[model samples]
Target: MQLISLCSGSLAALGAVLFAYGNGLSKWGGLAVLLLGTAVLLLSLSLQRRQEKEVTRLHRQIMDFLAGKNKTPKFSVNDDLFAVLENSVVELESRLLLERENTRKSSKRNADFITDVSHQLKTPLAALKLYCEMDQARNLGAHSQKQLALIERMEHLIYSLLRLEKLRADVYELQFAKHDLSRLLEQVWEELKVLYPEKKFTIIGTAELRCDAYWLHEAVKNVIKNACEHTTAAGHIQVLLETSETVVTLSIEDDGGGIAETELPKLFQRFYRTAQTKASGGAGIGLAITKTIVEKHHGTIAAENTAHGLRIVMCFPILDGVLAAG
Candidate 1:
C-alpha cells in the first residue's frame, strides 16, 4: 500500500511538470497520469478506512468477551499480525474454565469434611453429656462436677469452631431482614441472665437496624457473654444501641478488669487469648465468631479498654431508604 502511494505521488508530480512545459500530446498524457494518480489515492484511502473499521469491531468484540457479555468470540480478520492476540484470548478462556472446575471440586470437598466431622462428634458429645448427668445424679464429688464442666466446655468449643469455620468460609447463607434492636436486646439479656445469674446487665438505648436476626443475636450474645465472663460479681455490664443517618452502632461495656492495652486489637482474632482470658477457660473463638458475624453483614467490630473494663463496639451501615433515628 505504501509503495502504491509513493509511486502514485511521484507520477502526479511528474505529470504537473509535463503539463507546465510540454506540447499538446505530452500535456494530455500528463493529464491522464494525474487523473490515474488521484484514482489510486482514493482507492488507498478506501482500503485504509476498511482496515480501521475492522480494528474497531475487533476491539469491541474482545472487550465484550472479557466483560462476560459474550461466551463465544468470533474474529473476522485472518491477518498474521492478529494471530498472537487471538491465541492469547483462547488460552485465557481455557484457563478460566479449568479454574472454575477446580473451585467446584474444592467446595464439595470442604462441605463433605464439615458434615463428617459434625456427625462424628455429635455421638460422643451426647454420650459424654449423659454420663456427666448420671455422675451428678449419683452425688459424685467436686471432681465429677469439674469433669462434667470440662466436657460441656469441650462441646461448646467444638460447636463454636464449626460455626466460625462455616461463617469465615462463606458457606453459611445468612438471612437478612429488618429486626427491632430493642426486642433483640431483650432476648439476649434474658439468655445472659440465665447464663450469668450473678452479674448485673443494663440496656441504655435502642435503635432499629436491618440484619440477619438469628446471626446478629448470636453475635451480640457472644459479646455479652464475654463481658459477663470477665466482669466481677460486684461489676455491672451496660449495652448502648444508637443510630445515625448512615450507621447503627451497638456498644457493650463491662466493669470487669480491662484487658491490657497491647492485647486489645488481638481480642477479636481467632484462637487468640490473653493470659487472663486463658486462665479463665476461654476457648478464644467467641469474639472471633462475633467479629465474623458483624462483618458478614457489612459491618465493623472493635474493642477497647476503658477505665472500668473492656468495651466492644459494633457498627453496621443503615440500609438504603430506611429512615434515620431522631
Candidate 2:
C-alpha cells in the first residue's frame, strides 16, 4: 500500500510539473503541490508499516502463550488500529483456552467414571467366567486344569477390580453397621492369608472402632493388597488398630522400599501407580479407593516413609450422640 501510494504520488508530481511548464504556470506552485503529495504518501506508508508490525507481534505472542512458553503479561490493547481485532482475537482465545481447560477436567472425570463402571461389572463377570472355564469332568486333562487355574486367577483379579471400582465410585457405598471393629480386622486378615499365603501380615492392638463396616473392611483389605503386591515372599506387613476417646487410628506398613518422595503426594489419585507396581498387574485403584472410603467415613488418611518402610496413618472421628438430660 505504501509503495503504491508513493509511486502514484511521484507520477502525479511528474504530471503537475509538465502541466505547469506547458501551461506557463508558476513553477513553485507545482513544486508545492508535489511536496504535499509526497508528505501524504509517507504518512500512509508509516501507518501501514506500524500496523503490520503490530499484527505480527500479536500473532507471535498469542502463539507463545498457547504453547505455555511466554508469560510476558497479557497483551493489553486499550486503543490501537488493530484494537477491535485484537479484542476479538483475545476474547476468542480466552474462550478457547477456557474450553481446553474444561475439556481436560472433563476428560479426567470421564476416565475415572469409566474405570469405576468397568470395576463394578467385573465381579459377576469373573465368577461367571471362572465357572464356565473350569473342568467339571471326573478326570481333568492337564491343559484344561491349567486353563482352569488361569481362569480362576483372572476371575479373582476381575473381582478385585470391581470392588476397587466401587470404592472409587463412592467410598461409603457400603453403609455403617454396628459390629466389633476388631472382629472385622480379624476377618480381613483371614481373607488376606488366603489371598497372599507367602506374606506375613500381623494385626496388633485392640478396641472397637466406629465406622462404615463394609467399606472399612474394603479399605483395610485394599491396604493389605497394596502391601502384598509390593512386598517379596515372607515380607512383613503390620496392621495396628488403636482407639482413643475421640479418634481411631489404623496404621498399615510394609518392609518394602517406600515410594518416591515426589510421587508421595499423588498416592491417592485414581489410576496413579508407582514404578515398582507397574510390572505387577494391578488396576492402581486400591489406594485411591481406600482414601475415598476413609474420607467417606469422615476419616483422614496420610502417607509417610518410616524407618523400615512406608506407613499409612488413618484417623476416624468417633460419633457419639449428645447426652439427654433427665
| Highest TM-score against the true fold, candidate | 1
Q: By summed lDDT, which 10 consecutive residues of candidate 1 come out lowest? A: 317-326
In model 2, the runs with Cα more than 4 Å from the true position are: 1-173, 321-326
Per-residue alpha-carbon lDDT of candidate 2 for residues 196-298, written as tens digits (9 for 90 to 100): 8888877788756655677778888888778887888888998887888898888989988788889888888877888876888565667887887787676
- The Cα error of candidate 1 at residue 145, in Å, is 4.1
Local distance difference test values of all predictions, in order: 0.79, 0.71
TM-score of each: 0.60, 0.51
Residue 207, model 1: lDDT of: 88
lDDT tens digits by residue: candidate 1, 1-326? 67777887788888877777888999888888888887887787787787677578667765565445656644435666555676667667667757755865775576567667977998988898788788889887657788788888878887887888777666777766688898998899987787788888888888888788898999999888888878777569999989899899999999987988899889989899988788888989988999988987778999988889889999998853221110
Please state the error at residue 260 of candidate 2 in Å. Answer: 1.2
Superposition error at 306 for model 1 (Å): 1.4
Indicate the residue-level lDDT of 20 in model 1: 78
